[model samples]
Target: MDRRRVIIDTDTAGDDTQALVLAALSDRIEVEGLTIVAGNVEFDHEVENAKYTLGLAGKADEVPVHEGIRSPLQKEYETAEYVHGEGGLGGELFPDTGIESADAHAVDYIVETARENPGEVTLVCIGPLTNVAMACKREPDLDELLDEVWVMGGNVNCLGNVTPAAEYNFWVDPDAANVVLRELSTTIVDWGVTVRDSTFGPDTLGRIEDAAEDSEFAAFYDTITQQVRAFNREEMGEDATTQPDSLVVACLIEPDLIEESGEYHVDVDEREGMTRGYTLVDETGVLDEPANARVVESIDAEGFRRLFLDAVIHGDPERSLA
Candidate 1:
């Protein structure tokens, strides 16, 4: 198999942990590194959560973790402890591995990796786009160097998890989101609507829980995502777990699993108001803007479920390494 090389910039909490499980165990991709940023929690906890997560899957040594910018580029640093729970692991604590994040800063790691790998590296931003934007600032040609930039953000489809007009990730750093969408040509973005479209119902949940009995990683995932499961049921009225970040990773591993809404010129509102962090997509040709990113309006839910479950519960370790 022609394995894809990838880097994930993440907030490292809640559903992001479930998403990390998919990356850690995937048989068709090599997760080169994970850069931790502040969003769902603070810098310290997010980094610890990331390390705990990697260690939980026994991939702690294989995939190095990097520390990224804590605050947004321009906005004040905000946290989501209420949503992700303290410590970003749904208030659960896995015994500390005594491991520390890598010495390199996340922005520099991103820049150096993309410069070294060229088009072979896929950078998936599952949190705010701060690290990627900072990398591009340091290397203006970064957009041309990487393979693809898959982002699990935006809210162009009557959706908003954090605000009336913004997705949580984008709302965290709209400035960075704008920078990446405007500069990177190889981008595939997922909107908040993707979460609603990609959830696995009660039966799959039961299967995953049952599989947890045999796999430590699966059981850990089941325990950590409990808050998310309850939140979704209460807020969205569904007994399902929505892993949009995992959907982005699955699509990166296999683009055919999702249908494209077309290449779009997207703009994010970076002000503070009712429309803050809103993503404005150019659907019609009237905008006359060059398409910098492809939008995923819908996906093959079954295909995503299969890819996620297979990776998390039945994947081969050999394929997950470099």
Candidate 2:
């Protein structure tokens, strides 16, 4: 099979950075480009974070990073600074990429690239869906332009990180989320519950640490993930942490790591207040709507741990230092 052409859209913070590195390291997929959106941090920090991540992995020379939407379509943007830290990368500051973010706007780039390679591009979106929705609105036939989309968002059980009924990515931009959930034909959805349950505990982290021993990438990954682990310890009392976005990339690289919930019609609430952004997953055909997605309901946590550690540890950072 041809190397899967992929464009990763992200709000590069703690785990998103890890996801980016994994994609950069994977030989089976070619990263066509990277598009940034505002989510875990502000738009500017997320873009720079992407560049900094690329620099860390030595993939800066390969991927073209593009700036994306700063705010949601109908709401003011909010960030998870407490979880991701003040500077987005767990407060461990790194030098600027020194490479300028690409001149092409994210929405335009998404449109043009997907159009150029029909049924060959996969957008791995790990953040708010603003850029995608905007691009689709611009081109009415955007669905025909791309092959597949894997978006990491929503919660089927209504247990969410940002709010009781919403995940952060969708909560930030329900209007965009709604559009993507309703209109995008080939979307592969990853829910918060599935990712949250399939987490990396102390054992997995120990493996990653041992494998990444003495490498700068390992230290950075360890430090950046500390905040999340600490928070998880305090909240859940078990240091079971997750890089939810990375799971999307892992599923792409090795599909067996994920199990889907078949085709289900999904809807996102766009109204204001508590319930807004909730992903109404109609599992039993209760909504009586056509299916637009194959919802990922479970992941092989152990399988993912092994695959993620293998991919991330073998990157340039680990080998170059040898």
Candidate 3:
């Protein structure tokens, strides 16, 4: 099978790092490059996290990292350091991999790459949609150039992560999210999926801890996930930590993992109030609008954990984590 061509756009915090590791190590996807955006933490730190993540898969020199928008398109930048910690990797420090970002601006790189590979590239956006919206505005035909865009943001029918009415990525830059969702053929793997399906609790955590003893990658995963696990348990009242980004990536790598999905007219609310950045998914067809995106509502949680462990521990997805 032809490996899916992908470009990961990330904010590069704890779970974001896990997502990158999944994309980089899996033989099922060809990571064209990584575009860093402003969200999870400081912009520079996010860029560094991307480099460090690539280094884990021994793809440091092969995959190019490009720095994108430093702030939201129309709002001041916001971060999730409270959840991710100061270093963006649970404050863990490591020796430099000597990996540097490409000199190209992320917007330019995104536009050029799509133009060069029309109908072939897929952008897996796991952060705020600033770079993507800007690129679409720059090249109006961008929607037609790329094959697909997979986004890890928003919420379908439930509560959100960042706010009671909105998810973090869409909340950070509602303007950008609106632009991209309106203009692109997109698939949304929302916060609902993370909360409802792919959460890793104590049992799975113990499995990873056991795998860490024999796999350096699993050790890295175990180390970085500590902070988020605590926050999830204490703040969200959930004993499990959610990896939204990695779950979205897994759906792309293995489509069978998606247990349920639907096509809907999905848009983010940009108005100020209690509902700012709230994803207005027309799940009931109240809008009578044509569906513009596919919304993934659920996935096989067990399969996701298996896929994640297989890749992180064995560096391949063919092996069974169970």
Instruction: Please tell me which predicted candidate would have the highest TM-score against the true structure.
Output: 3
The residue pairs that clash in candidate 3, if any, are none
TM-score (all chains, Cα) for each model: 0.93, 0.93, 0.97
**lDDT of each candidate versus the true structure:** 0.80, 0.80, 0.88
Candidate 2 structure quality by residue, lDDT tens digits, 187-241 = 5545564465457788878866786666666767787887888778888797766
Name the best candidate (by lDDT): 3
- Where is the poorest 10-residue window by lDDT in model 1? 313-322
Residue 181 shift from truth in candidate 2, angstroms: 1.6
Candidate rank order under TM-score: 3, 2, 1
lDDT of 1 by residue, 1-322 (tens): 8888889999988878777877777667788999998788878888888888888777899989999998999998568776677787777866777887799999999999988888889888899888888888999999789987788888875678787788888898899988888778745555654665676789988887999988776687678777777777788887777777878877766777776567877888999888888988888857897877778877777777776777666753333223
lDDT of 2: 0.80
1 or 2, greater by TM-score: 2
Clashing pairs in 1: none
TM-score of 3: 0.97
